[model samples]
Target: MHHATPLINTIVGGLVLAFLLGILANRFRISPLVGYLVAGVLVGPHTPGFVADTSLAPELAELGVILLMFGVGLHFSLKDLMAVKSIAIPGAIAQIAVATLLGITFSTVMHWTLVNGLVFGLCLSTASTVVLLRALEERQLIDSRRGQIAIGWLIVEDLVMVLTLVLLPAYGKLLGGESETMRQVWLDLALTLGKVAAFITLMIVVGRRVVPWVLAKSASTGSRELFTLSVLAMALGIAFGAVELFGVSFALGAFFAGVVLNESELSHRAAHDTLPLRDAFAVLFFVSVGMLFDPLIVIHEPLAVLATLAIILVGKSAAAFALVKLFGHSRRTALTISVSLAQIGEFAFILAGLGISLGMLSPQGQNLVLAGAILSIMVNPLMFALLERYLARHDPGDEETTDRQPGEETQLPLEVCHHALLVGYGRVGSLIGARLAEAGMPMVVIENTRARVDMLRNQGINVVLGNAAKPEILSLARLDCARWLLLTIPNGFEAGEIVALAREKRPDLSIIVRAHYDDEVAYITERGATQVVMGEREIATSMIALLQLDAAKLPY
Candidate 1:
């Protein structure tokens, strides 16, 4: 319990440092994490400036990691976890085991003690979920099978990371203390695991019951900040409690707490609230990591760094590819997933700190490892990007995203091509869908509704369930190639924004905007919109057309 001044200093410093470095990193096309590391090194005791309390940084970093994992769990619903589990679990396990083995081999070759080698291996086995998820999003692969498999693989890595955090320390202690009995070590390890299990059970049973009620009661305050604070308290409190009382790793507790909240209505909201802080704190975690890098190691021990990088990438990726394929997948899918996940993560940051505290490895060795971690963090995204391009070009699993409508899109006024574009798939969207199916033009409907996604999918149509306003949805529809964009939502404000956003991306897109008011018709027309339909005008236009057809039937 220090005063407010230090707390403010720590937060303000971390945030300012993060923002500036992040911008710089962005400008350079480098991982902002590297910037965070650089920022930490500058502020660390090794430098002359306002040195932060050494422990303060990691403590704050723990907050970031916990929130990040919590956010991951919150968004990674039970459905998603189960959906991807088939590949993620197995892929993750094989990757970790292989990477760890490789790390151990390298350390052993370097004449490290057996314990040090194993610890080194464990650290190398994890991947930064944050970096990978962002990369997946950027590459727009989140909806693909490879993305699903990659996610599942990461879950396995996370589980292994937790186990290593808890079990490795005991192993290290028993190995180091010649007098410590094997029986004693086993007892401690078992107790630790039991406590971890019980902690998980308690969080699931008790927390599931309590958190929703808390969120429900608190949400009416209509204060986003309060909601954010509540989420933070729950995450940090459980994480800290596990460490203080049950002797479980904070990472495990944080993850379990996130799992408990997976069932809550506020899961996504909770995730949104925690992300900014997670990002800032996560940056510190990376930055603190950078401070540990001794420039001398790279200069004098070049082989060590090169060897570590090789073992992490080539050895781990190969292991992952083989294990995943053996488990059940095409070689292409397995290779793509494994290759993408071949790097280290923030968990290793915690592990490195633990290793230093336990004196298991020399500071120099730890520095080299931290340097490697930063380099990996920086490189992981680029590697994933390269792998994505390679998979797209070569793998069947790398199919380009397309919006398959449940049925055809029918409209009063429209353009037609090899495909029909359904802008909104609500009740109106669905009705148009049925008509289009009858006509048999390849129909492509883009919708924002989640419930109808599977419903449409069940009907053998390519249903893109996302914001139609986004250029990605437009590109998915192949707007330049597709002849029409059927806009169903008649809200003028949303329509304008969507139109603007679309035009910004694709200037020649032909959209038939659905309008409710006469003023909006003028507004839409003035903007050079292709067409606008008023609800009243739709009935009138059909009535006149029907009359004309009736007159023609009279043989006039």
Candidate 2:
């Protein structure tokens, strides 16, 4: 007896397939998003397989968008958002106009009406917030200047999409020859803008107070379940309320909710608790997006599909690249911003659906949008990889461009032999450096952060300024003569790469690396680390040692 379980089936099928393909994708050095989308395509109605409920998937994906935005908000403060506004605001608007114009041109070539082309252009203009955030988080760049600018730019795009969603219906009335007055159109636009303003103002003024209070009260109960539930309730409830009463998008609503909650002392705990749910739902979001893609669109309208994808990939990226350059940013910053905005996601789907409902977009147009989204998203990670390689090849010395004096060589002094090479100078690295300094030990620090590198230089310490993963940076540390290679970076994979490089350069060099997990320990050790200090294991060992001590005199 088979029970009717569409929701359960959808969730399980999506997750299992996503997991399997995700592993395969990672194995091949591809982004797991490609696998998730592939899984969706397999289970999608367009394919000959067990089709999952498409309607439920998007709703589940919406939760992903909400939670992802919420998590971003947790880390992004009001100050950070305001800091990037000068570049993000005008750059985003200009990029959107350029992409939209490109879209309109494509539509005209296809003999589409002006309204249809407008809808199509709009769909192609906005980048998916979820994709951009995920990319930043993966690279650990979410807090970087480039990441902040990308995020702020995305926020502006979201606002524009929200306005478009609200006004599309009124536009529909006019398209349908309903004699809708220009006054009504203006009224609708004003109402949407006013509501959005009110929501933002309310969240900033009232929410900043009430949200933290609620979390504090929940935390005081000492019930972890209650606390987690309170977080979810606030995220979901505020999002729903924003939609129902405030006419705001769920992504924006949940973002403000997280922003207010960020003021709470337990915001870190909140983020930690919801991380599993956030990741799982984010996978579902990608899977759901995949399910919408009809592969036949590619077969039937190859040129049109290619044209749409070119708009998303090339046209949008070039426009963004030029805008960032116009703002006097570096080639690296411009490339990063451009690549980040080269894909459209949830908002595009929403706008495409609305367009179809309003008769402004045909099914073919919607299919084209879906195709563009899937292809662009799948290739986005690869684009980033290329950017990394390009940067590595051309700008291996990240700080050497303008900061370094002409004819300066990044070599250790002839007197500084048998010195320890520290790969990071963050919190852990700084503590180790202090101890080394006190002992009067000679050491060289390899750090990527400009400020930290500058501070180290001012302290009269030998430091290499660039990513240690670069062979030149490693060579600058005099790895051949270094007594020890200390890998203190939190990123285990990156640490492993540096370890391997150092080992290949100096087989007898003692390599000590810090790890947060057993797998990291194993990976780094396998790459020739002499010792892997597992933080949790060390803490446990210390705790056990304390337990063995005499209880009466140990503490009161």
- Name the candidate that leads on lDDT: 2
On residues 312-401, what C-alpha lDDT tens digit does candidate 1 reach at each position? 677777787787667666666666666677667677777877887877765655766776776676677667667657766776341322
Model 2 residue 20 distance off true place after TM-score fit, in angstroms? 1.2
After the best TM-score superposition of candidate 1, give how far the Cα of residue 124 lies from its true spot, in angstroms: 1.7
What are the lDDT figures for the candidates, one per model? 0.68, 0.87
Candidate 1 regions with alpha-carbon error over 4 angstroms: 1-14, 45-52, 137-148, 176-180, 245-248, 330-336, 356-359, 395-556
* TM-score of every model versus the real structure: 0.70, 0.78
Cα error, candidate 2, residue 535 (Å): 9.1
| Model 1 lDDT, residue 29, Cα | 81
Candidate 2's TM-score: 0.78
